[model samples]
Target: MDAVQGLETGDTFILHATFKPVPLFAVMKAKGFTYESEQLDKKHWKVTFVKRGLGQ
Candidate 1:
């Protein structure tokens, strides 16, 4: 969350977690970010959050 604080439009923040952060997706979306998630292994996941520009 701190990583996203200074994001400009179109900027991206990547997060690594032990499990899929499903709830966070909605929170970020509400803040104008879109996300993509990938499972790295049995216990690791990577989520990338991108801030959308206006009219996107």
Candidate 2:
């Protein structure tokens, strides 16, 4: 799973630590977000899921 972007523990993120809600980082990985695993650390990931629609 991916990590949260601009993660500041608070203020910048919603900080969802609940079983009902999946971790933001996990959500990112599930969305197919990738990175240079060879160079990147396990703590640096911020994948987001944008809903696709006909129009904004």
Candidate 3:
């Protein structure tokens, strides 16, 4: 929730995690954010979350 709280409309953030945060992606999508995830190596994931024009 901190990530979401830190962002405003049209803001973007890159989350780098040790594993793919599939659940987080789903939750964010449900909240009307857009995202793309890329797996780097076996233990790294880069997820870009964007707060688009959503009422939140």
Candidate 4:
């Protein structure tokens, strides 16, 4: 979660993982980030998150 800690307003992060990161998604969503996710293959997923304004 280092990415989350370093995020600033209007920053975006993209991550690729071997499995769907449901727990990570939950934490980021709860922290007021907006995101989209897509499955790229049987064993890969991509998730993008944007950090908006504070308390968003």
Candidate 5:
């Protein structure tokens, strides 16, 4: 969460995890971010979060 606090509008952060982080989607959305999730393989998933502009 600390990492997210540093994001500026239009900044993107990519997260890699062992499992699909479904819960985090809602959290990011509430913080004005849009995300895309991709499963790389059986054991890895990648989620990209982009901070949106005001009113976006």
Candidate 6:
């Protein structure tokens, strides 16, 4: 979570959490980030979200 605080201007990060999906998106949104997610390898879901704090 601490890494979330130091997000660069236009950096993107991949985050993993428990076996839930909706809540993860909710949390990322609440933290001022836009995100997209998909299931990875059919085993688990991988979420790819972007932090739009700044730009290049």
Q: Identify the leading candidate in terms of lDDT.
A: 5
Better candidate by lDDT, 2 or 3: 3
| Model 2 spans > 4 angstroms off | 1-22, 35-56
Model 6 pairs whose backbones collide: none
Candidate 3: deviation at residue 22, Å?
0.6
Q: Order the candidate numbers by TM-score, best to worst.
A: 5, 1, 4, 3, 6, 2
Q: Candidate 6: where is the Cα deviation over 4 Å?
A: 17-20, 54-56
Highest TM-score among the candidates is held by which one?
A: 5
- What tens-digit string does per-residue lDDT give for candidate 2 at 1-56? 22444333221222222232334445544544322212133444332333322332
Ranking by lDDT: 5, 1, 4, 3, 6, 2
- The residue pairs found clashing in candidate 3 are none
Tens digits of per-residue lDDT for model 5 on 1-28? 9999989999999999999999999999
For model 5, which pairs clash? none
TM-score, every prediction: 0.93, 0.22, 0.80, 0.80, 0.95, 0.68
Give the C-alpha lDDT of model 6: 0.72
lDDT string for model 6 (1-56, tens) is 78778886467888665444786677877777888777665557677778876431
**Relative to the unseen true structure, what is the C-alpha lDDT of residue 45 in candidate 2, on a scale of 0 to 100?**
39
lDDT of 4 by residue, 1-56 (tens): 77688888889999999999988877888877888999999999999999879666
Model 5 scores worst on lDDT over the 10 consecutive residues at 1-10
lDDT (C-alpha, whole model) for all candidates: 0.93, 0.33, 0.86, 0.88, 0.97, 0.72
lDDT of 1 at 53: 92
Better of 1 and 4 by lDDT: 1
Candidate 1: the clashing residue pairs are none
